[model samples]
Target: MESTSPLFALRNVTKVFPGVRALDDVRLELYPGQVTALVGENGAGKSTLVKTMTGIYQPESGEIWYDGQQVTIRNPEDARQMGITAIHQETVLFDDMTVAENIFAGSYLTRGRFGNLDWKAMNRRAQEILHDIEAPLSPTAMLSGLSIGQKHMVAIARALSVDARVVILDEPTAALSHHEIHELYELVRRLKARGTAIMFITHKFDEIFAIADRYTVFRDGAFVGDGRIEDVTEPELVEMMVARSLNETYPKVEAPLGEEVFRAEGFSHPTEFADISFAVRKGEILGFYGLVGAGRTEIMRALIGLSEQARGEIYIEGQRVSVRSPADAVQAGLVYVPEERQQQGVMLDMPIYQNISLPQLHRTSRAGFLSTRNELAVARQYGERLNVKTSSWSELVNNLSGGNQQKVVIAKWLATHPRVIIMDEPTKGIDIGSKAAVHAFMSELVQQGLAVIMVSSELPEIMGMADRMIVMNEGRQVREFTRDEATAEAIVSAATGVRA
Candidate 1:
């Protein structure tokens, strides 16, 4: 395979940060019309390799090959010109711009004579691209008004508009629904039929097996293995991801749930959620399963007092509690780990110690002065417990990998010792190895008598970890399932309000 000529290839790519060697002696090949699935643990140098190939990062030592010819891509424009384009894990679209405007952003269509913007032609072209992808969205619609799945489709449309020969999709289905994911698969098939090579990066093994023709596994900044998708079992892939056999990924522990630790009654928030009610006991994990607009996040936000217009009765430890703000919720022994980790969870520019200690500043301060010793001690403790990969606690959070950054966020909350924790899409963009680590941590937390309310889109995670599950549909709790009773079909039916 290595001897065969590839349409696109990365030869011995290496990237280094201050103390971190992000990628080391890595190599990959993307054959024409083949979808290669990139798999690894978070921080396994997957992002670094992609960034290097896409011109977000210049490799310290390596060569990129296009059609058996060596090339150096210095910027995104250069990569695009060379028929390389990447759709990031996070959708990068202008919220204020229309779909057509965003699709043709830097290179807008111009009319004859004067260089006037050709709005009609641009919209028509955008509509044509969307039609090709089978996406149900208007070209004139504002990006902010679209769902996460819709935003993802728009990104794909943008990539297709460039007529890219090699398309890289990073965690494309992290926020998409089953129907939308099917649409994406169809689009990928069409692209492949047209002889376009694809590099797909995802944590979902099911999707990988479904769409990928070949697979590559990365571990700790190095390539471990690559082969045909049919040649590998799910367990084998899992072992390759973590570099070890995982005995039990979920590792459920039985703990007697105590009286209700947190309760919401008649919770209502306009446009977000309404008429939601549930109770979570100590030493229990209450998993919430829903589609993108099923009001899972809105309910969690209301519980943490992030929604101003939220109206409800919240009881903590059987005592009525009123949370008017985030501070109020924190004072009441409740904390929220937001879905957008970069925007809300941690301060990227700050050091790990500072970010970890931010949530509990008052505890680490003496008479309004922060105690550096206390901060460092706390950060080091949680960092080690979470297995955060870093040279030191003084390292910046942004410098760490996606999974390590997530650990820092969890460590920040754990430092505060909240009784009830609401986690929104905790493992959304993380790799399978880090995801298992997080699942283990959650199980441990519940065993230690902490109550957890987890909102997730992945059915397997919910079924495996939750003691009880609640399915939401369009802001309503349509069904509930015990750990023994929940199945993929049942959960999907409940979430989509579809009878089965």
Candidate 2:
């Protein structure tokens, strides 16, 4: 009972960026009342194609057809007017304004002879949309007062505000909790029922299978294939997206763990977490798992003194240490590679070698002068060791792909010679191939007597890589499991605070 023609279609679309062709005759078709899953690796041009669709960029060549007629989208305004809307991974919203104002920021309801802004109309409509989505939020509430999940609801309402016919959700569940993700799925179903064409872009295979009606694969910026979602298996879809079958992931290297290298005792924060304690041995990989707001990240931040109010006792190499700041933490042989790699990990504007040499500048200085030779040598050694692909050492950190940038951040910390390395979401936004490489490198690192504490939301990653696991729930350490004792079911049960 499906329509023969697509509601929106991009045919033979091409987009070129400088020397690179971002998209090469890529094609996408979104049928009415159907969810099309756009599958791709990290650099597979999904973002580029999205920009074209939302009119952020005009394609080099292609035809965009809507409702059986070709349409020209000149800018974002034009796209919005054409009923095309996008809810990006991190929706750009104003923090200072009310929910209603954020929803109708540019296109507000106006009335009267002078065409004044109609605040009452906007608020009422915003409240109606919020009610329909089952989001209990006030239209006049300040945007900053809302939680991450509530902010996602406002973004969805904004999409509906434009009467969007083509709704694109780009990694919308990246920051959502379990309940929030469920609510988002319901909203997606509601949109589909209204004959809205939805393009769902996500990397999670389970999500793709759960909701997608059709799947379109893209590899290296070109269309690989398209078919019904039920017609393809997970492995087959991955093969299409990556152009090769992936081996068993999480190549955990099992090495002999040595004496405890790092320990946290009575880790407590008044509002964030309470009574959290753990220990990691040298040559060991320890994983922390939890849903959002589980206080895993809060504890990590406090470990390195980002949270001044956090009280904790940290011991390094069997010696009591006082870490008042990240600098002190580094001096105590403890370093953290933060989760927000783009924002907190690497300095995007700096060159790769400079970013790598940032932590250990004293080692790269001779006679009170920065030694470019030594800096480049340190970067070269680690880049080769980590298999970071780059055109040149002088290239800006922003120019490297996600995997290579991650390498640069790790290299920055490795230069510091820390006894314990805490990696928060080490492989969060990178591609599958890069994930394998990072995993292999992590194993290699532990083999050299380094203690690794990895905090990840990915269950498979935690299960596959960690020698021991710790589950957190509602800002408390709920359960601990050795590698032999851990299973997906038991771990999830504890992390979610289920009494089974």
Q: Which stretches of candidate 2 lie over 4 Å from their true place?
A: 244-246, 399-401
What tens-digit string does per-residue lDDT give for candidate 1 at 1-500? 22245799888988998877989888999988889999998778888888888888998998899977999999889888887888876788999999998899887899989999999999999999998878889999999998777888888888878888899988888767778788779888888886788999998888999999999999989889998898999989989888666556666677789888999999998787879999999999999999888989988988888888889999999899989999889889999999989999999999999999997888899999999999999999998889998888998999887778888999999888899998888887888777878888998888889999999988888888899999999998999999998889989998888996
User: Could you tell me every candidate's TM-score relative to the true structure?
Assistant: 0.89, 0.93
**Model 1's TM-score against the true structure:** 0.89
Best model number under lDDT = 2
Highest TM-score among the candidates is held by which one? 2
Candidate 2 per-residue C-alpha lDDT over 103-192 given as tens digits, one digit per residue, 9 for 90 to 100: 898888999999999999999999998887778899999999987778888988998888889999998888787888988899899888
Worst 10 residues of 1 by lDDT: 243-252
* lDDT, candidates in the order shown: 0.88, 0.90
Clashing pairs in 1: none
Q: Quote the positional error of residue 84 for candidate 2 in Å.
A: 1.2
